[model samples]
Target: MESNQLPLRDIHLPEAIDWWPPALGWWLLAILIPLSIALMVWLYKRITRQTAIKAARKLLLQIKQDQQCDNSQKLKDLSALIRRVAISATTRNKCAGLTGQQWLEFLDQSVKGAPFTLGIGQLLANAPYQKSPPNEQDINQLTRLCEDWLNAQTKRKK
Candidate 1:
């Protein structure tokens, strides 16, 4: 056969890659991106909450250690610290405006039994309005109770 008479093959290119149904890496990234964002948000919230609790605990310890404050002053400071911690760690509506038995009952809910309502913790409510200052023993018990309640509040989940 003569060279001019031979048949020739046409140049053919491979098919173009399909854009749909992305590769595995892209799919993993699509799933991981939202999950990582959600995890970060959750971690941020948890850290802030724990930080608030740690700061509150430090303040409570300082209040307990102060010797200059009299029984009445200590009672007032302890009560204020409890209120501040409760308001910060819990919903304001759940803790604020609670008084007398109601306040004690709210505190009791966090720990075992009704320590606040039935035990020395009750002193918190009456101490503020007493004719004389609370006794040293009662003050000590109340301090311990307040500290325990603070610890319980810290361990609680949202």
Candidate 2:
């Protein structure tokens, strides 16, 4: 065969295509999926903080109604409810491992100084197993402060 008459072969080049999928990457998806889930959880907790506080309020109301029950128990329950809700609403790292005045300060900081002032914080801190139960007025104040904190948290999220 003459050099000019040599058989021609079709050369196939890689198709021009986008390397990235329209959908995001597995790594991005992995990060994003967890982030989205975390965001959802945070949002859920923010919205429901009020409900938890409300439940606590109801418990307090019941405690008030039950004159026979130990006041200390009621106080302890109230404190536990608030702590649980606080832990749920914010990162455990922020609220956990906090005790005594430090825990009260944590609550104060977490709520951004709404209604939970140093006094309220102190009350909550000193509440555990106290022989003297928190009176109706004290419980009312605590409930109000918790509701305020929940409201403040919700507002911050929005």
Error of 1 at 143 (Å): 1.0
- By TM-score, the best candidate is 1
Collision pairs in model 2: none
Predictions in order: lDDT? 0.86, 0.68
Q: Candidate 1, 106: how far from true, in Å?
A: 1.1
Model 1 score (lDDT): 0.86
Model 1 Cα shift for residue 35 (angstroms) = 4.1
lDDT of 2 by residue, 1-158 (tens): 78788988789899887757645676688789999999998778666766765675676567557777665666676677778877766678877778876777666764755345465646677766466777777776776676666556555542
lDDT of 1 by residue, 1-158 (tens): 98788897779999999999899999999999999999998888777778777887888788788989888988888888889888878778998999999999999989999988999988888776778889889988888888888789777887
Model 1 Cα shift for residue 117 (angstroms): 0.8
